[model samples]
Target: MSRKLLNISIPVISVLLGLLAGAVIMLVSGYDPIQGYSAMLSGIFGDEYYLGETVRQITPYILAGLAVAFAFRTGLFNIGVEGQLIVGWIAAVWVGTEFDFPKVIHLPLAVLAGAAAGAFWAFIPGLLKAKYRVHEVIVTIMLNYTALHVTNYLIVNVLSDKQDKTENIAETASLRSVLFENLTDLSRMHWGIIIALICAIFMWFILEKTTTGFELKAVGFNQHASEYAGMSVKRNIILSMVISGAFAGLAGAMEGLGTFGYAAIKGGFTGVGFDGIAVALLGGNAAIGVVLAAALFGGLKNGALNMPLEAGVPNEIVDIVIALIIFFVASSYFIRWIISRLSKKGAK
Candidate 1:
């Protein structure tokens, strides 16, 4: 019981500490923390439109978080989720624009194309790591720049129509749902949220209820020991990266088919993939945890605009709060020590 409570309490306490630190900063900056927080909360839940926008934002965060979490669980650090996401976005938009199929076929096909593209992109790093002992961190990081340039070039040369953005995807390939729009006061929310939820469930099942999961986890725990135990570390590493990239790709698909319905040439990284690392850490790399963490992050991001407008606080303050939260989460050992001391005092 204590162990279970500890597991839950650590993150909650870390969040509280982060907020407290942010409050201090706000005080020093001559901003009203209470007003800022209140406005932020109201912004997130003020209307159906705001709520729907938060959910829309959460959709991709969930998938991206899952991507990082999955790789972490498999003993791989997949920093290239950003690159994978970009390629996936490009692939989905390409499929959506180039093809004209029935809605039933086109939407799924485009989404799948995104996932396949991400998987293929990750496969290169995976293969290199497996065959040559190359470090995945460096390889994936470099690939992020590669993905950005390659996608930008393709958009300019092949996909775009004399603009920086690709043409709107075919309606048949879109993930937007009129039903959700009606319910949410015409917000950009779409059926992609349903897909995100389903993928979360799928990840949970795959990680917790299967023999393959066990093998993958074993490889993560100790590659040499797993090899001695007859598990193929190389195969698991490749498989883990492919699966991780697929999740990130789905995140990109949510943007391409559901949110934007097109691809835009990016001058820089989308930052979603980088944020995934924080989400996975805060979530403890668990599927359900990732979902909740993503929602929190989504709420913060969605509500940031209102903080400036309603409370006269700079929206960048929210970024500071987020960074503090990550810092606290990273230094969770201090929190654990505090909990242990309090527990001993209570027992005494």
Candidate 2:
């Protein structure tokens, strides 16, 4: 119980520390930190449009967060989410552009293709790690490069438009924001958010309410013991990686089908998959916690884009703040010490 409380308190304390660090940096840079923070808060929450953009920014973060959290629960670190996302994005766009089905059939098919692509991409590392005892961290990292180059080649060669970018997907294949426009007057928010939310819920159910989840957790805790108890540790490891990849793939789909309408030319990933590590840490690998953490990250990311336009602050300031938060969370012993001292005093 105390440990759980500490986990919750750590992020709160990290936020406070990050804000303080940001303020100090602002002061050194000869700007008012208060004004900067105020502007950031306002841009993210001041109006309906801004709020919608916040959610839009959050869409991919949610899925990415889930990807990382899912892997963490299984004692795996899937850094290949970037690769998984790229393949998923490519598969989704391919399906969306090639299919001529009605909305009901087309949309689901495209999304499922994305998921399958991601899962398949992930399975490679899972198999290597489980069967040959290769470290997943190394394999996933290498796969990131593979996914990047492979995706770049496909988009620029086979799928490229006249201008070298892929052609826009058909309207029927796109996830429309018309419903959100009616409510918030900001069309940026789309059905991707709904899908992300559902995925989170589904994962929560699987992790918290299912026997497979228990076996996975057991393996995460002690693979040797789980294997001794007749659980298939190797299979569970592969399954966990595949599931993690699928979530990452969904994130890629959100960025493509939901936002860009098609896969566009890219120098590299936008780092959403990498950012998922921080989100999962901040959320303590909890499903509901992932949603909240993603929202915070999304607000920070979106608001940072406007800070330069409004306050002359570099958007990288947000990255620095995020780094500080993650640093403090990783070194949460300090916060725990302070909390323990405070509690001792209160008890007296």
Summed backbone clashes in each candidate are 0, 0
Q: What is the C-alpha lDDT profile of model 2 across 272-335, one tens digit per residue?
A: 9899989988988999889989999999998887777778787788889999989998888888
Best model per lDDT: 1
Give candidate 1's whole-model lDDT. Answer: 0.92
The C-alpha stretches of model 2 lying farther than 4 A from their native spots are: 161-163
lDDT of every predicted structure (CA atoms): 0.92, 0.87
lDDT tens digits by residue: candidate 1, 126-150: 9999889899999999999999999
lDDT of residue 269 for candidate 1: 95
Model 2, 160: alpha-carbon shift in Å?
Answer: 2.2
Clashing pairs in 2: none
Cα displacement (angstroms), candidate 2, residue 111, comes to: 1.0
